[model samples]
Target: MRSKTLGKIVLSLISVVSLGLGAAGPAAADSAPTAGAPVAGKTEAAGKGGPEGIIGGETADSSRGMAALHRNGNFLCSGSIVDNRWVLTARHCLYPEGERIPDSQLTVRVKSLNRTSGGGVVAVSDSRVRTEHDIAMLKLDRSANAEPVRLATANPKVGATTYVFGWGRTCATCAPSTVLKRATMRVESIDADDVYGGRAIRTSGLNGRTCHGDSGGPLFKLVDGQRYQVGVVSGGNAGCPDDSGFRFASTPTSLTWIQNVMADF
Candidate 1:
């Protein structure tokens, strides 16, 4: 089993390169490309390394309220804006199983395709973790002003199409992507468990799969041209880009908790 600590260690190492690049300052926001739209059958070769990014994926054309999480200026994980003041992500991104992470050490960049720049960075004022589920919610210090994604009230059925987004590595040893990337996948098992053994949604890569740095990223299901977040990237097996073994905590399993947390904010 991929332990929760394994996920943290992988992400920590990935952050080294990110910290160096971030020190140089944010790059100019690249013009919105027409390619951000979801492609039906796009794929890329996986790079050799441990795990990271969407192996065999394409650059995301739209941010769709995605947020790049950073810890002490180093890229950490990915998240989604669920409200003007709330960002939802994996609990492991915040800290270990039982520990608490200080709100001051975390920040989220929202409304941008580029993680290093081109988005508003907001400090976290408060956070809540659903320990049993491996999911967490961060309360932004102020409104993000970015659009929020709707949380699904139920899990997608097996074989349902889904999409995942992140700024993780493209290859095993590659640095994390500066631009957001996404992959097409199919729900493989709604009965799976996350790294922490929380109820999770397992997916098989159709054209791409979630890897390192993708922790806490959103797994979205499209309905009526609308995007509903059905899962949060938790962890996966080591063989990324292999078209199997991606797992995300099922959002519907903890919808009531999410609502209560949001209501308190």
Candidate 2:
């Protein structure tokens, strides 16, 4: 059966304060190319925001290699630093209606968990994406000066706990969270294909769900007490404040695409 194709609805990149990037960012990430549709289910409307609280989760102090992709100072989507000069994010994040936004129109903030304050900011020089999946690789004009995140060498176990980090909304109708929010979810399945025919890792979230504005956010798994990125936030059926939705992303399946692109960057 064909899964319902829920468009990639990345939250509007609205900022609380001016981060000096100007106000020319894309209005919203609504029409951009996306990873896939929401996990199997009829669409539901709820408090659409990312996860919160430490029910075994906590507000991350620093994601080390995390980066917030901004357009004209407005928050767009989340990305993971893969190399000193490259960031891995959802391909949909770079285009709106299939037209690629120029690198001059974007900026990447790194190091700080807080999106508005305390981070190294740099202009993007270039971006590379493949149509096979919803992943993209960005080249920074200069090094981010922060350590890049490690890619998982193997898929995570179905029952293992994983963490998601993002600056997505705190509520469906609320503004984006200023500080990076972190939540812990259990891996429910691996290698599940989304509506777009892309393989994804599905996770179960109770109090913590990946919501709007979290597109391309990193899903990390602890390997020997070290954080390794195993997935990227793609989409979910409903928003937050309502705790009954599953989150899915391109991870183990994306590793090859990520590596091939990074090698050329």
| Index of the highest-lDDT prediction | 1
Over 1-265, each residue of candidate 1 has an lDDT whose tens digit, in order, gives 3233334212221232334434111111112111011100112232344322456666677776688888777777778888889989887777632345688978888877777777678888999988667789999899988878888999999999888888776765565667787888888899877756678888887777666567778888887867788888877655343667677888999889999999976
**Backbone collisions counted per model:** 4, 6
Instruction: Give each model a TM-score.
Output: 0.82, 0.78
1-265 per-residue lDDT for model 2 (tens digits): 3243545532222222233432211111111111111222222232333434112234665557778878777766777888888988776666643467788878878876666656678889889875645677889899888788888867788887777776666655544555666777777887654434466677776336655556667777876777888777665654443332334556667777778877876
| RMSD list, candidates in order | 7.2, 7.2
The regions of model 2 sitting more than 4 angstroms off are: 1-57, 96-98
lDDT of 1 at 82: 87
RMSD of candidate 2 to the true fold?
7.2
**Which stretch of 10 consecutive residues in model 2 shows the poorest summed lDDT?**
25-34
Candidate 2: what lDDT? 0.60
* Candidate 1 residue pairs in backbone clash: 36-61, 49-172, 52-212, 53-169
